[model samples]
Target: MTFPELVVFDLDFTLWDCGGTWCDCLRPPFLKKEGQFFDSDGRHLTLYSDVLAILDDVDDLGLPMALASRTERPDWARELLKLFGIQDRFPYQEIYPGSKVKHLKKISDLSRVPLDKMLFFDDEHRNLADLRPYGVRCQHVASGMSEELFSEGLELFA
Candidate 1:
């Protein structure tokens, strides 16, 4: 298999833990320090342990990355990304409240990468199912993006 032209990610559970709640939507902006984010309510939001390593590996492969998040609080998501200093990692982002299909379509159209040539990672099973018809090689990120899953994705698209 050839490597995908683009890789897309889901923001919330796939990247970071939002305390299993929408507390990420709270009023105050997140605090960034020591490589972690603390929400307004002092709830901790952290990237999966393997996130940086995986991202670095993907970047080393010269693959472009994008974000497709159906997060209700788009502002919060953006803020978190910025605080994490990963905002520039994904040049194409769609973080509105909508179906994953719509997000993937927009990313595909914007990046000019065919659905089949794109690899997507999301935490929701429904999202994986929804993207199948679009020909997107979707992977379910159960706990978060892990090295094993990342390798599987690489193999699938390699």
Candidate 2:
């Protein structure tokens, strides 16, 4: 039976269906004032429900799960997770601002898990490309894509 020892996720686009570049709406407020930003559409996005369910299932199965993002707002990110009610599913150290490649490498080293045993899902091609050479299982989804990618990602770790 194939089971992933570690599952990592990229935030922004991969988790939010905000209908455009995830960083676009956030950059101005986030970079400038360290404040929050909600586009004209408001906070109307949600991750695929299956993703949450899968996290829960992975927990039940004793698999590890984490989030990795280049975002700097640790507080707000935690609040967002609270909004989604999945904050406890992840570890605090798993949410950090650095190159995803760096964070993933650190995670692998600290956990003593080989890169090949890790599964990473991101909506950006660049992130996947950078981590690919390290032997991490990486999947990249197109910007503004649909739930199909989430399904495919789950299958990789399933």
lDDT per residue as tens, model 1, 1-158: 58988999998888887777653466566776686678777788888889989889889989999998887878888888877779999889998987888998888889898899999999888899999898889888888899999988777766
Give the number of the best model, judged by lDDT: 1
Q: After superposition, how far is residue 121 of candidate 2 from its true place, in Å?
A: 0.6
Query: What total of clashing residue pairs does each candidate reach?
Result: 1, 0
Q: What is the C-alpha lDDT of each candidate?
A: 0.84, 0.66
Which pairs of residues clash in candidate 1, taking residues 3 or more apart in a chain or in different chains? 1-158
Candidate 1, residue 115: Cα displacement in angstroms equals 0.6
Q: RMSD for each model, in Å, please?
A: 1.7, 5.3
- Native-vs-model 1 lDDT? 0.84
The residue-by-residue lDDT of candidate 2 on 1-158, one tens digit each, is 47778777777877655335453344222221234335344444456545666676667768777777776666656556665667777662456666678888778777778887887888778888888888888878665324566456557755
User: lDDT score, residue 97, model 2?
Assistant: 68
TM-score of each: 0.92, 0.73
Candidate 2 residue 71 C-alpha distance from true site, Å: 1.3
